[model samples]
Target chain A: MPYVTVKMLPGRTVEQKRALIEKVTDAVSETTNAPKENITVFIEEMDATHYGQAGVMHADKK
Target chain B: MPYVTVKMLPGRTVEQKRALIEKVTDAVSETTNAPKENITVFIEEMDATHYGQAGVMHADKK
Candidate 1:
């Protein structure tokens, strides 16, 4: 089973998330040839304070 | 390039999370031979309603 996870900031609306899951499922299915039903998708929403990049926290960005 | 994610229910203490990341990083390093610095660990906390098993939501389980 190919489990796909989308990790990003936490402000998307429900409709956006719905579209994201559908589109991601289709893309992964097309590339990996896995059935849509068998592909699991997990959305991880991270707060700015909890995420860091290039040795700096997102919350500290100016 | 080895990215490990630990997905579980919420409520672990900060010390527990610290130990978890350390132990998991070490284990992955030992198994995959990836350097400790090259490994990235993400912790995902899921509510019972957001997770399901065997076609049943975790929140619905008794």
Candidate 2:
């Protein structure tokens, strides 16, 4: 069972998300040989205030 | 790099989220021998409508 989760900043449209889910499902299915119906894709969105990189909070960095 | 993500139905308070992150970090650090500062925890919330099991979506389950 391959469960793929996409973590990204919010602001994407519904169409973008649909495409992302479709493409990721295809890639995962192809590489892992998991059936398309068996794969699950979860989209998780976090704002800049909740993100950090290189030991610095994104909100604080801004 | 063990990045931990918790996906659950929303409704927890901010304090609960803090505790979740802290405890998850501690557990991961202790088991993986990774430094606390090197661990990252992300909280993701999804609604029942977005969840499914056994070919039935949660929203449709009810």
Candidate 3:
């Protein structure tokens, strides 16, 4: 089983998420040939305060 | 270093999350021998509509 986690900013609509899961499942299945049912995708959303880049928190950006 | 993520339904308080992160980090470190700072832990929450089990969406359950 292949477990994939997509971490990004919050605020996507349900439609976007639905499409994302489907497309991502397809992509991973195509590349790895893992069964759709066997592959699990988890979406993680992080607010600016919790996410950091280059030692700077996203919330601290101007 | 090990990258671990805990995926579950939403509604956990910040204190619970803080404890979860700490304990999970310690467990991973003890088993894998990875340093604390080098380990990255992500908490992903899913709504009923977005999560499914046994071919049924969590939202569809009674």
Candidate 4:
């Protein structure tokens, strides 16, 4: 089973999120030979401040 | 920044992994209005035994 967690910025249409989940699940299923029903994809929306790179938060990275 | 983590069964080619990352990044960027560099997608491969649902481990779930 694949528990795919996608953490991105907030603000996505429900359709978009759903589509992403479907596509991601399909990709994993195809590659891993796992059944589609066995895949669990989780979408986590986070504030830019929660992420950092090179000692700089994502809100400040760019 | 989006820290997208894709956790699935092990056994994918480097090329496949790279492609998944790129595609996921693009999807997030286009939908979230976040810059590509700000998206950090992490791929984690887990044994089916590690994941469970309905109180059953994935290795045994399906």
TM-score of each: 0.53, 0.53, 0.58, 0.66
- Name the regions of candidate 2 deviating beyond 4 angstroms: B2-62
Per-candidate Cα RMSD to the true structure, in Å, reads: 6.4, 6.7, 5.8, 3.4
TM-score, structure 2 vs. true: 0.53
Stretches > 4 Å off in candidate 3: B1-6, B10-45, B49-62
Query: For candidate 1, lDDT tens digit of each residue in B1-62?
Result: 67776778887776566667667778888898888777766667899999999999998996
lDDT per residue as tens, model 2, A1-62: 69988889898999999999999999999998999999999997885544443333344545
lDDT of 3 by residue, B1-60 (tens): 699978798889999999999999999989888999989899977876565432334455
Q: Which candidate is the best by DockQ?
A: 4
Model 1 / residue B22 / CA error / Å: 0.4
The digit string of per-residue lDDT tens for model 4 on A1-62 reads 56778876777889888877877677666655678898888888878888666888878866
Q: Model 4: clashing residue pairs?
A: none
Error of 1 at B61 (Å): 1.7
CAPRI class assigned to model 2: incorrect
Name model 1 segments beyond 4 Å from true. Answer: A1-44, A47-62
Put down candidate 3 lDDT per residue, A1-62, tens digits, no spaces. Answer: 67776777888886676667678778888898887778766666789899888999999995
Count of clashing residue pairs in every prediction: 0, 0, 0, 0
Q: For candidate 4, give the docking quality class from DockQ.
A: acceptable
Q: Model 3: what TM-score?
A: 0.58
Query: Each candidate: what lDDT?
Result: 0.76, 0.75, 0.76, 0.75
